[model samples]
Target chain A: MNLKKPLTAETISLDLKGDSKDAILAEMVDLLVASGHIRDREAVLKAVLEREKRMSTGMQNGIAIPHGKTDSVDCLVAALGIKRGGVDFGALDGQPSNIFVMTVSPDSRTGPHIQFLAEISRPLNDAAVRAKLLAATSPDEVLHLLIG
Target chain B: MSGPAELHPLVQFVFQLGVLIVLTRVGGYWLRRWFRLPGVLGELIVGMLIGPYALGRFAWPGLGHLFGLAPGGGAVTPELHAVATFASIVLLFLSGLETDLSAFLRYSVVGTVVGIGGVVFSFYLGAGCAIWFGLASGWLDPTALFLGAIATATSVGISARILSERRKMASPEGVTILAAAVFDDVLGIIVLAIVVGMVRAAGDGQGIAWADILLIAGKAFGFWIGATAIGLLLARRFSRILKYFQSPEAIAALALGCALLLAGLSEMVGLAMIIGAYIMGLSLSRTDLVQVIQKEVEGLHNVLVPVFFATMGMMVDFGAVQAVLKVGVVYSLLAVASKVLGCGLPALFCGFNRHGAVRVGVGMLPRGEVALIVAGIGLTSGAIGQDVFGIAILMTLVTTLLGPMLLAGSFENPASGLRKPEDAAKTESKEIVLSFPSPDMADFMRARIVRAFRQEEFYVYRLAPDTPTYHIRKDEMFFTLECEGDTVVLRVTAQYEALARLVVVEEMLALRSMLHMAQENVNIETMEHELVAGLFSDDGEDGP
Candidate 1:
């Protein structure tokens, strides 16, 4: 509901390393837990993993958004990251994904789930926004690009 | 508790369906991206997760009770089924409608043989594996074997999608996989009949006999024959009637009505509704209706297929699968290996080199959702204990699970730009002739052909004059291709004009044509159906 929420450098800098999708999700989970936004990081990670074990959410446009909701996360949280070289998210289009918007919400509300999907999907609908995200110098630039 | 007028049915359906769709899309996208699994599998898995079996969501209060869930909580809803069923019909029909029928026509012989071999070999192997596992553990039953047979089906839609992506679909190897798959489908259907008959026999006192098997086959075949003959004749008439419906709404309503009616009739006859839908699609395939129907059907399926696939997830309890986890893993691996070894080895024997064999094997690996349908049949029949079908589902899980990687791997360094002219000619050649059992297709040969050859028109044959008196040169080689209703007969004379004159004509060779198919099938004029060919003079020209 709050589209104008301020994102700190710490909030924006997500863990993204390696072609392995799990490593990225793991880093993001650890970051969220360390930030104290989420309890039981393992539960959140398991939820994400199990959800993925259901299907791959790689949008197949050099974008992969791995997401999950669990009781372990209180308010809705999103970890936005960019992998310039792209990670193999196992997309149907056979293209590697570079942008990952990992979102976690409470176990119940489907609202946050759809909202997060929109936040990521809507930006992706814009070529310039995508270009900005890809061209940004740092995670701070990435956040500015996102908010801008 | 309110009156029907208080809550509009449309609003209710939308509300319920909205949840399923959003959940499915979000869940499917996330799971698929995270797990590196197929979208369909993800949809189904999430359906299970959010269904009553896991956490709870909106329930079809009626079916929730049927599923032993406490009232008013679950993922199962009637509104979803309506769309899901619609999608299933379109999905299967589109599969039938979209099939590269020409590939099957050209490579019918080798593909049929290889496909049959794959199906029979895999069925028995899976059965053997089932029996062995059962024996080692405790005991084996017919159910496990049945489950194995079901596992043997190639799930053509999945394989086709994968093959199309790799650009290997039209290659001899690709064509062979598809052909064999269609052949396997036929065999699978027959095998399904036998198994179902056996089950029926087990239930009642109906004895299993060659007579009865033949009778059942005959009935199924007869039903199809009768239906096809009626359908095609009607399809033509429908084409006539289709002219009356110029508006999109009119055509859509008509198509939906026809589809639903055919789907219903198919069930009354014990055939898979998809089979009927396929035949319906094939019938319409002959008319301009295919394009219109395809567009309409896909439009509908955009709303339908995700739900069907998602509902499948709701039905599968992957969390509770720990009991069958070990067997699932083992069978899944075997399923992958058997297709590789069983299908791959024979392709090698058929003069395809190792890469060709590997291509064939990899092409056959993705089983798609029909495998789950087979697993369902097994579980419901009590032929396979829940545990055994559970294992069968495991195999589907793996095969469907690995589609993306297998596809990516197959395309890694494709064969160096197809076979050479001479080598490619050997694999499968196309020809079209004017005369019945025409000799010396030389008259149809043209010397000094035009430049700018289209790749589809790669083999240009110029129709030149050649006969006893004309006596076109014997040494010249040519290739010919033809189509019914459509014609691309180019006769290009050899580099040597004198050599080009002679055309050794072979007698018309009818393929392993099934008499039943020919009898009931109507002759429709489709340019696409024309036979395309190339003629080579045996001395220079080869003729039988």
Candidate 2:
């Protein structure tokens, strides 16, 4: 399960324009729909928002992973966004979050979704990799940095 | 100029009740703390000490005899007796609610046979004692039948407590004893119904025959079976209806109202009121609402249950007991022997070895609330005199005290009670521990874990209010979750270990996300200011 298979360049945003957490999530969902990854836009958005309501996905170290499981998507699909200004996304360290990685997977499957999370989370833990991804100006650069 | 004014009967009765409650509570606490005996025994002893035949006979300056006998023969007045009767109904109702219907069904065959054997042996021996000692005219005499009925019930509470203390609750013998105790309660109620019916028949000058006895037994059994069937069928719908009330207190009150109504109906139909209460409770036992109802009504139970026991003690006449001391002692020995043989013999045939059989029998030896209730009924209804009632109390005291000691001693050998030694390994529980960085985090994770299980339709409730422990149950799967400081532990069997881990993993993931959310949303400056202001407030002077 290659992380690049689900997270493609078309689904990556180099500069996220959303000023808030919900706005950033909505913008990422739009990217997934535009890339023809998500069949039902509203269902995926609802699932993601519902999961966020239970607990914020804004993790420490300026990283956020907002994910949900729903039947709206046929398979695992992800969208990556970078907001340089760092919006307050309820991070554990009480700091603003800049990197947003949202994934929507089929509700019937669990293995690939977990594997995708584990693979994506590994590279984000490195300070150098995160710095390079945040500095990357193009969607292709961001995807390459994340997958590599 | 004038003699001290006579106190009104109602005022006198209220004074007596107040005194009785205070004395019983103090006595119960003293006995429990010092002797490690059940509080009920203390209440009984206190009642006897302060009863009309003892200190109560001494007249005070302003008041007459403190606990003077009522106009009738009983020690307590009609008003006190009425309250005691209500307390007994509550006792039976709670017992019904606490019954583990699933466990009862799981061990049904062996439990039923064991229960039947106990009732049969106890009844025969109990009745024979009365007849042999000239307390009754014949086998079917009211006193003899009452004695037999009184000996049939094994206090499930006492046995369960001892077994759990010994950590043998999962043993074959422990489960069998518990299952048999449930059967003992049901059968005891049925036997009481039969005895009441027969006694009433005899009072009406009807000729007693074998056919009449069968008909009476059939009627008693029919009523219990029919009521239980209808109650169980409607339990779920009844629980939903109760939920409509919303508040726990309101729901509990309404449920208790139903119990009282059913109890009254049972009395009207010639069976004991407790039988109706028990059936009502048994029906609701399977519903998730049991924990809520039990928690809400626990305060009322604590206040009233002791009153009932103390009242039973007050009813005991020492002079009468002294006259029948020899008879009571012999009768108590028979009671102990009958339960052991009756309950033990059936267990032997059901996969238990001799050691297991003896353990099961000894575990079932304690005769508690139900026996006292039956004896109380007999005394109140004039079916038995003070002497018979005294003998019943003697038997209860003897078995209750002896039961725990013998049961604890029986486990000293530490040998497998099961015929197949391999089965013993199945009783061991697999434990899973999850530690957090801080106690607060553990508490948060524990709450979420419990909520996760609840969402999956498990009936989750705290084991006790004072402890950070919970019982999670769904159908046959049961788990114990304990949260202490920075650690949370889940105890379950191997079969359910995967499920337990899955729940914890899902909850921890959720907690991780929640911590992130909290960090982003929470403003450190405002939170610190609020915390400092609240801690240093002037209103703190009145706080603990």
Candidate 3:
């Protein structure tokens, strides 16, 4: 599944403040809310976290996709946070996860949500893209590097 | 990458791990497919093949460097050895977790009887063999006692893995074997303490003090009982303390930290690190955190256990093997016979039939890590000379190899119902839901919905994506991606759900952390407060 909507620069942050996965996830979920991407912060945070326990979304190459599908957001919503000194996301590779792609969707939409997840995952598979995303100075650079 | 001197410590560790994992997999597959032997046997062989005793002996350029040796690698470095030791600790920890405490308690009577029989018989028989067949007379008593103690040890990891692979973990014979093995470990350690203490006493020109002997044994048991009681009492509070943090690494770190702490403490009290780690596992075995600890520690175990096994393989000195070859055969045979007769008769008397008793006896034959440690201690302490130490090592290697063969054969005799069908169909299903439920309604409904499912029949997880895709267990039903969309599709397939409930608890903690971040003032100490008390209590009060 490929994501139809483009991730805007407004919802992306280069400086994530949390030292742990939960704290980072909270920061990311807060970004999505502050950016008007999702409405109920607690509900979305709970849903994203509930999904987290099933398994970590931390992928190889220091990327973590912490996502949830709930009615807290009307349509597809996504946010990104980057911490220079990575937080332990309990990745299989046992490396700290630096790049976080947070997504929240309406509970009714399965196809587009799956597509969005796949789309985020696909670009991350490229080492060059991953490196570029990590090295990018701002969210604009990250968006261009990821979605370009 | 060019030289061992230039490679980063992290890089060296990664390379070593990569080599070990690849070789263990390939070698283990070949052994299982062709010889029908345990994978561990193959790992040991592969380890020897690539170790300093063999390929590295020839000064294979890159191989030596990769294993953390000089260009022409001589021995594994202290750093690498430390890694193996860490692996050993993790291995013992995992063995402890896999232990069924209730079953251990249930079979304690028979297990203790069988264990004592095996220990006494093996000790006396092995000591008699060592003393009678040996030319030296002056140091006979201590040497024989040390050798006897070495024989009494049973490798819980080796036997447990073999039984698990055979799918006999739940069988009566397996339970008895495990119980006996546990008892054997405690008994073996005590025997070692007495022998070592006696040797030290004689070296100092003093007779063995009865008071000192009693004290040492008391310390061993006291440490175990005390640690278990204290650890269990504190485990729930520790779990609650951990819930305050959202890092998945926190739980594993805490668990491993505790294991190491106890291991160090045990060593400080003159007990083995393995004993300490095992005790730590037992202490947490009944707690809410056992599942959580198991979930986080599995990854560490996979990496470290192989290192321990492979390093053990590397310890086999070919010269020792050659020198002791003739005596080794006799000692090995004596070792096996002693365990079989010693452990077997007790099992038979304890309501097990002839075949079950034989199986139990065969199971105890592998003197893996424990034997090596005992031999090493004896050699270093001068209780046994190099040649005798060589003989002990040879005896350990032979017994280790012979164990799986006899164990497999005993299982194949078909007289007992212990052997489960290898290809039994599993009834569990893994459900993947691609639904477009309202994001608002999804969170409100999840806890309520999942709570309605009987906890006994269905184990559910809200966040389970932390597991590697390959490791995504089949039996677990996990909910993910709560988003609003156009349609909902549910797909169900059979899989394992062993980690199902553990995942839910982990998710609840994660959510708790999130809530703490959202509300800076609320002090949520447990899942009940944030999950059940805060959210679920007012479920119907809000509608999307």
Candidate 4:
């Protein structure tokens, strides 16, 4: 139920350089790889992209939750990215998505991934919180805004 | 007679079969559309017309007696008759597969007693007629036993059609009639098995005693019950094995193969082959493969079932029928009365009133296909003569024609058939309706809900091809989801209401998340293009 356990400052990307949906997803996965949370980068990326093919994870209000299940991660790992100018991620409302919360969990497990998604979705649902998180300059600041 | 030096029997059979199929199809269709009667009646009439006693007796210059009897005085060529017999096996096999085990259990208490009553009454009455008219020596006579066995079958299809047409399918009487009909079929088959065993025993030159009769009945009943029990237990495993074939047609063909194997085994064990075929079907009835197998084998069913009926018709000796006209009439009347009194009387004690009883009784009157099949077997085995077979057909035609009329009339009163009327209210299921803004939205929601349930590991399948209805089942839980235009309806029992609501809530949450994603991903370029196009249109020039 705690978002702080999975969404760490090390895994937060304040200024995402990726200009496209696939690029942004790769940028986010790179953060998780950098933090040493994922064992196999390709496996995690393949899972996330495969999940995206089923349905666009780009939600409303400048938020998107791209998630996948893969055994490359022993537990649930997440990375948060902010594309301030926004990128087209096939959001439901036909608007660009600025914030992305990507989670990769072990395929054998289920509960922690759904719990993290639900927790992250709650704070992102608030317009004011999304705006503050989008404006945050530092990774630590982004983490505090999301977790707190 | 000299033409073509007497064409080969195989060639003659091929010609006869081609003619039979063409005439029967045309005749069946005409009867169904013109008279609103069952197609089987038309098939029978057509068969009789083209049979040896009529048009078949005449010889053509080249094809002498194209539809005539076989050289040894059989009604039809042995090749054609073999196909007809195969058709009967397929018919019973499909019947067994289509049996509604849940419904059968649901109405077991009332249905069991009513079924038993109908069988007991009809058997005795029919056999008594045979004996009184000098067709048999006593109750133990093979002809008497065959007559009784034939009488016990009540064609559920005939009654079900009538009840469905009247929109009384959910009525107490309707449910009871259907449930009892299921039992009637099972019991009728059992009776046939017992009779076949006895007849075979008698044929072996054994002096029939009371003990021997009991032993034969036990062996027949035991084989059916044992096979069905074991088959049900192994059905799921058997289905899994069949899945290895990976093709629907292969699975269906293999299933029919198993049916045939079991049928032959049944004969080895001294019971009727149809019983084994029925057992094989009943075993697989509870598995997920029922619909798949049914859809795959439907082509085979349509091509063969009519031939079986028509062949039975061809075997009807009109000369023998006329010789026993008095007995046939009396027997037909007794057949109708026995079903009404036997089946109806039991319904009154269950929950139905006199009117309801009459409906149930009338519904059970039609002996239809099963009776004909039994009589055909009797004649083929020489347990009964042509005259008896002719009388059996007479009874089938009479009851089949009369059943629908009497069933329709019984419902004319527009009164509740239940004794208290409140009992009808008690069995009504709780329905939850979810209304959408449009039919498209409803369809989308219905599909998503079904997908969610599938993800939850519920076995989901469409109930019928033409309807937007689905049946969901997992473990002990069951629900029927139906989509009607802009509304989706879920019907469940009271105990499952909480579970149903939980599934709905989870689906709604998933939908909300999807909606959120759609809103967030909206493209700014497309919206701007639409706006620009609208603002700079030729019509906008006049407005400006």
Q: What would the per-residue lDDT of candidate 1 be over residues B248-277, giving only the tens digit for each residue? A: 667756866776688678766765565576
Best by TM-score: 2
Whole-model lDDT, candidate 3?
A: 0.66
lDDT of 2 by residue, B24-82 (tens): 89999998789877677899888888877777676656777667777665588888899
Query: Candidate 3, residue B421: CA error in Å?
Result: 23
For model 4, the stretches where C-alpha displacement exceeds 4 angstroms are A1-148, B1-5, B60-62, B106-108, B204-207, B427-544
Judge candidate 1 at residue B184 and give its lDDT.
68
- For candidate 2, the per-residue lDDT at B209 reads 72
Q: All candidates' lDDT scores? A: 0.57, 0.82, 0.66, 0.82
Name the weakest run of 10 consecutive residues (lDDT summed) in model 4 chain B. B1-10
Docking band of candidate 1:
incorrect
- Writing each residue's lDDT as its tens digit, candidate 3 over B239-326 gives 6786677576797687778899988887666666666787777766655565577778877776666666676566555665677577
Which parts of model 3 have CA positions greater than 4 angstroms off? Answer: A1-148, B1-18, B62-74, B135-146, B156-172, B185-211, B246-248, B372-393, B411-413, B416-544
Model 1 DockQ (Cα-based): 0.00
Docking class of 2: incorrect
Worst 10 residues of 3 chain A by lDDT: A109-118
Which one is best on DockQ?
2
Q: Give the per-residue lDDT of model 3 (tens digit) for A1-148.
A: 2333537777889999999988998999888886676778999999998888767878678988888778878777888888998999988688999988887878754334533555565677778888887888987788777776
- Per-residue lDDT tens digits for candidate 4, residues B1-544, read 1222266888888877887888888999998789877778888888888887667777756887777777778887788889998888898998888776655665448878999999999999999999999998888889999999999999867676676566564456765676788788888989999999999998865547777898999999999889999999899999999999999999999999999999999989988888898889889988879888988877888888888888899999898889999999999999999999999999899888898899999999998878988899899998999899999999999998999989999999977677885664543345778998899988988998787666554556564343576666543345667788999987664445545664665566667778777778767656656667656566675232
